[model samples]
Target chain A: MASQHTRTVFFISDGTGITAETFGNAILAQFEFKPRHVRLPFIDTVDKAHQVVRQVNHVAEVEGRRPVVFTTLVNVEILQVIEDGCRGMLLDMFGTFVRPLEIELGMKSNHRVGRFSDVSKSKEYHDRIEAINFSLVHDDGQSNRDLDEADVILVGVSRSGKTPTSLYLAMQHGLKAANYPLIPEDFERQQLPSALVPHRKKIFGLTIQPERLSEIRNERRPNSRYASLDNCRMEVAEAEAMMRRAGIRWLSTTTKSIEEIATTILQEIRPERLEY
Target chain B: MASQHTRTVFFISDGTGITAETFGNAILAQFEFKPRHVRLPFIDTVDKAHQVVRQVNHVAEVEGRRPVVFTTLVNVEILQVIEDGCRGMLLDMFGTFVRPLEIELGMKSNHRVGRFSDVSKSKEYHDRIEAINFSLVHDDGQSNRDLDEADVILVGVSRSGKTPTSLYLAMQHGLKAANYPLIPEDFERQQLPSALVPHRKKIFGLTIQPERLSEIRNERRPNSRYASLDNCRMEVAEAEAMMRRAGIRWLSTTTKSIEEIATTILQEIRPERLEY
Candidate 1:
C-alpha cells in the first residue's frame, strides 16, 4: 500500500546506526509523508560505503526520486565515497556537529568509527546491567529482597502498563525500578501497599483508560470478570482514589508512550537522577 | 569529584530529550574529557526555555567556561529565546538540519513541540507493546506456547546475557524475541531443546568469556559449584561446540554493549526487518 508520495529514507552509520535512526526520525517528524526506513549499519569500510551508495541509488531510481539519506559515519574517506556516489539528499549528521564542537573546544576529532563511549568496561555500564537485573528480579512484585534499594517504585492496576515502563526506566536511564500491581484486596483496604509505604517518596502511579485496560486484560485473560469493562472501571476508580489519598504523583498511560511515561516519572520523582 | 577538565553538557528538548542525548553522546565521544551530563526535557514553553538559558549560563559562569548545549526544541520562538539568552555554545539540533530539509522537501516544517511520531494510537505502538508482553512471557524458556510467533530466538548458557538482550530486542526493535538457556543436559544430549528445533532458522546464540560468566553468576549464587570458573568454562565450551554443530550464528557478549549485540544480531539474521 505504498502512497504516491512515499519516499525512502536511509539511516547509515559506522556503528549500530541507532543514533542515526533516532536523529533522522526526529528531523523527519516535521514533514507530512510516509517514510520507508532502511538502516545500513556497520558501514566502516569503503567497500561497504560504496555498496550502500549503490543501494541508495537503486532505491532512488525505483522510486523515481532521490531518497533522503542520513548518516553518522565518522571516517571522512568512507563518507566521501557515499557522498560522491549517492544521488540523494545526504545529511552528514556527524560532520555538521563535530566540526563546530572541535572548533569550539579547540581539539581534534578522534575520527573513530564507533563513537559510543567505551562503556564496555566503565562503571556506568556495569551499573546499567545491575539496574536491568534489579528491575527484572523486582518485576511485578516478584521480589521484596532489595525493595529499599529501588530508585523508583511503580504501583498500578493490572494491565495499566507498569511492567514495560519499569523495564524501560531501568534499561534506558540506569535506574533500579520496581513495580507492584494494585489489586482488589488493596483497594478494599484503601491504603498504599505496606511494602511501598516506606518508599512512598519514590512511588509513582500509572493509570490507563478503562476501555483500553479492558482491551488489554481481555487479551491476557479473556471471558473473565477481571477483563470486563465494568470491572476495569471500578478497579481504575479505586486505584486513582487510593493514589490521590496517598498523595502519590500519577499520570495516565492512555496517551503516553513508554518513553513519555518514564521521562515524566523521572521529572516528577527524581529530577536530580535524570543523568544517564 | 569533578575533574579539573570536566565540562558541563546539557541536553534540552520539548520531548523526552532521548534523541538529543543519543546524538550528543556520539559527537562527544570524539573528544577525550569527562562530561557532567544534564538533561532538561519537556521544555515546550517560552518560560521553560528562559529558565534553561539561565541554568546554562549559570553553569558556564561556575565552570569558568561555556557549556555545550544540545537542543531539539522545535518551536522557533523558544529556540530564539535560548539562542539569545544563553552564553554557552548552543547546538540547535533541529534547526541546524531542518532548514535545508525544508528547502529539499519543498514544504514548511510543522514546528511541533514534540517531534515524536503520533504513536499513541498507531499500529506500530500496539505492536511494540505486544512484542514487550510476548518477550516477557517467553523469557528464559518460560513458555513455548507461541514459539512460532517469535521473530528471533536466542540460545545461550545461564548468565550469558539472554534475558536482558531478549527484552531489549523487544523493547527497542519491536521484535518478538524468546531466549532459551543451553544447559548441560542439552550439551550432553548434543542438540538444542526440542521446542527450539523447529525455529532453527531464526535462532541466534550468545556466548561470554567463562571468567566473566563466572563473575556474573557468583553475584547471584555465591560459592556455588554452578558459579565456579571450572563449571563456567565447561558449559561455555560445550555450548560453543553445540552452536557450531547446529550452524547457528553466534556472538560474544564479553566486551559488547546490549546495543552492539542486538544490532549485530539484527544485521546478521533480519536485516530486512530492521525498521521501527
Candidate 2:
C-alpha cells in the first residue's frame, strides 16, 4: 500500500492536451495510486514550457516525491526545456513513439504546434460539424423532417439513455443519429412511430433494467407515476416486445457506458462506419 | 511523393480501441503517408487476437508492404499472440510504457480487459451524464432556470459554435455549461440579456468572421437576408462592440475546432477546472 500515497500527475501538451491525458490515464490505471491531476495545455512556446517546468519543479519540491509528468510536446526546444528543468519523472508520450515511427516510415515529423488547426479544415471536420447539427435537430424525435438522412435511429422508452448515445455518435464518430422515445402511445399501438416506419432498416433499440430506469426517472420527476418501478417495467417490456416483433437489434444500457453503447450500435448496424 | 502511396494502419484494442486510435492518430499525424485506417475494437480473447493477426497479415500480403499495427491489449497472452504472429510492425502501446511504469511504481498492473466499465460506475461518469442533460436543457437560451449553477455561459451569434463547444465541455470535462445565442434584440438594445446579467463573471463570448458566418448561415437559409454578408458584418460588429463595452472576455471561433474552443474557454474562465 506504499503506492497508495497520492502523487501529482501532469498531462501537458502544446495543443489541447487531450492526447496526453488519454494516453497518460490509460497508463496510470494500472497502478494502485490516487493521482492529483494538473493539466497544462497550449504550451506551444518555450516561454510557456519554462513556466510549466517551474510549476512542475515547485510541486515536486513540495510533495517531497517525484511527480509524474506526461507530455506530448513536438517542439524540440520546448520539450527539452521541460525535460531538463522539471524535477518530476517525464513520460514523453510523443517522443517515446515518434522516433520509431519516423525510422519505420523514413520521414521526418512536421512537429507542428496545435495540429487541430489543420484538421478543422478537413472534409471529415465538416462532416462532424454537420453530423452534430443533424443530431441536435433530430434529438428526442423533436423534428422528423429528415428521417431518411439519419444513419441510425434509436428507439427507447424515457430515461433509457437514447439522447446521450445519439449525440455521442454524432460528436465522436461523425454519424447522423436520431433518437425517438418509445412512449405509451407507441406501446399501445404495438408499432414503430409513424415517421420511423420507413427507416426500420436503420432503427436500433435500447432497454435498461426497470429498477435503474425508475431510479433515473425519479431524478427528473420524483415520486411521480412516471418514476414508479411498475411503470418502468411495463414500458421496457412493451418496448422490447415491439423491437422483437420488428426484428430490430437492441441492447441493455443499464451496465454500459455511453461509448460502449455507441460502439455496440455501430458494430451491429454499420460496422464500416467505425472511425478514429 | 512515394510516401503518398496509402498504407494500411490498424488500431487494435481489447476495449473500445479509443486509446489506441487516439495515440496512433497522434503519432501518424507526424508522418507524411496517407493511412487507410482499420479499427478492430473489442479484441479481448486469444481467438480474437488471432483473427485480427490473420486480417493484418492478409492486408500486408495483398498490399506488398508491412502494415503498421498499434495495440493496447493488456492481457499478456493476447498481446503476445499479436506481437508474435503479425507480420507487420507491431507497436505495443501498453507494453512499451507499462514496464517502465511498473519499475517506477514497483507494482504490477491489474491487466483488466475493458477499463471503462469501472470508470462508467464512478461518480465522475454520473456527473458527466448530469452535465450532458444540463447542457441539453440550457442550450440556445432554452431554459434559464439554473443559470447560477453553470460553470460557464457561452454567448454567441447563431452558427457561431456555441452549442457544440458547450456540449464538448460537458461531455469531456463534466462541467455544466449553458449557451445562449445573441439575437438582434440584444444587439438593438445594446445590453446583455437580462437573464445573463446576474452571471456576468461566468459569461464568455465567441465571434466568427463575417464572411464565415454568412457562409454557415447560407447553408441553413440560402439567399436570405440572414445569410447576407452585410447583415452578418453588422451583427458581428454589434456583438463584438457589446462584449467589449461589457468587459467580457471573448475569442474568435473562426479557425478553432470544438476541442480547441472548449479548451480555450476553460483556460480563460475556469483554469482550475481542467481535468483528465
Best by lDDT: 1
Clashing pairs in 1: none
Worst 10 residues of 2 chain B by lDDT: B1-10
Model 1 alpha-carbon drift over 4 Å, by segment: A1-5, A115-119, B1-5, B115-118
Give the number of the best model, judged by DockQ.
1
Write model 1 residue lDDT over B127-225, tens digit each, in one string. 888999899989889999989999999999998888888989999888999999999899889999999999999999999999989988998899999
Per-residue lDDT over B132-181 for candidate 2, one digit per residue giving the tens place of the 0 to 100 score: 99999999999989899999999989999999898889888888999999
Which pairs in model 2 have colliding backbones? none
Residue-wise lDDT of candidate 2 within A1-276, one digit each (tens)? 124545789999999898888888888887776778888998988899989989888877777788889999988999999988999888998888889888888888888666576643688887888998899899999999988999999999988999889989999889999999999999889899999999999999999999989988998999999999999999999999999999999999998888889889998888887642
